[model samples]
Target: MPKRTIVLSLKDQDIEKFLEYITQRLRGSDYSLTYKDGRIYLTIHGRPREIEDLIRSARKAHGDFMKIHKPVAGVRRYPKDWLVERSRGISLSLLIRA
Candidate 1:
């Protein structure tokens, strides 16, 4: 089954690395990724279990450097729609530490 799209935010520092990490983790799986408005959008075709696993792994890998915002399950939509519907006051901010 084709799962719904999910949106997640990553710290600027983790953007590049996280993309690589996620791409590898999802290898041989049915998933698509794109970035826009500073957020990464993931579209996967699989059970929620697999998707959830990806989320957990991502959180663990970038726990200290990234922040993730997930939508309530069963709400199906693309990233843009999810953002508008959820309307969480959350904002993506990137801080550079020298």
Candidate 2:
């Protein structure tokens, strides 16, 4: 299956709780989660149904934060190695200014 990604802008404080919830829900599924510059990046390597399910669950759990997030214009899947490098390169200071 082709990989898919979702980017969500939220408070840094909420990350731990969000991660716990998502990790629990995706216990038996294949997914990747990362944080960069106050944005949460989730990648699910699965079917459309699974992806929708995950998003729906997230919305229910974090609707307020989701509503305030900038809608993702486009989502492109980069290689795993590149993802790590790219996200790491995004500094908090740059994000604060943006």
Candidate 3:
């Protein structure tokens, strides 16, 4: 199994839509969603293809309210170290391992 991460920038009006989009796709999946510092962060445990599909769907569904950025994939790593360095805002950082 691999881990994937996605970062999305959204306006106040679009947060609910984004959450709905994710909830629809990620039903019964091993995933986590969190909002902090004016950003939406999604962490999922699944295949690369599935992850990509989820991101694409999310963008299409919430495109009007949110500006979806490109997804970043890589070897799995702990976020604690990176979080410490980032400013008081949420950004997308991914760690994926085979």
Estimate TM-scores for all models.
0.48, 0.54, 0.51
Tell me the lDDT of model 2 at 85: 46
lDDT of 1 at 1: 83
lDDT of 1 at 72: 44
What's model 1's lDDT at 40?
78
Scored by TM-score, the top model is 2
Q: Kindly list the per-residue Cα lDDT of model 3 for residues 21-64, writing each as its tens digit.
A: 56864677777778877678878777988777766755554453
Off by over 4 Å in 3: 64-98
Off by over 4 Å in 1: 11-14, 62-98
Model 2 CA deviation exceeding 4 Å by range: 64-98
User: Which pairs clash in model 3?
Assistant: 74-96, 75-96, 76-95, 76-96
lDDT of 2 by residue, 1-98 (tens): 96778887778887887777557646787788789999888787878888788776655545533433325565333333333444677864564455
| 10 residues in a row with least lDDT, candidate 1 | 89-98
lDDT for model 3, on a 0 to 1 scale?
0.60
**lDDT value, residue 84 of candidate 2:** 45
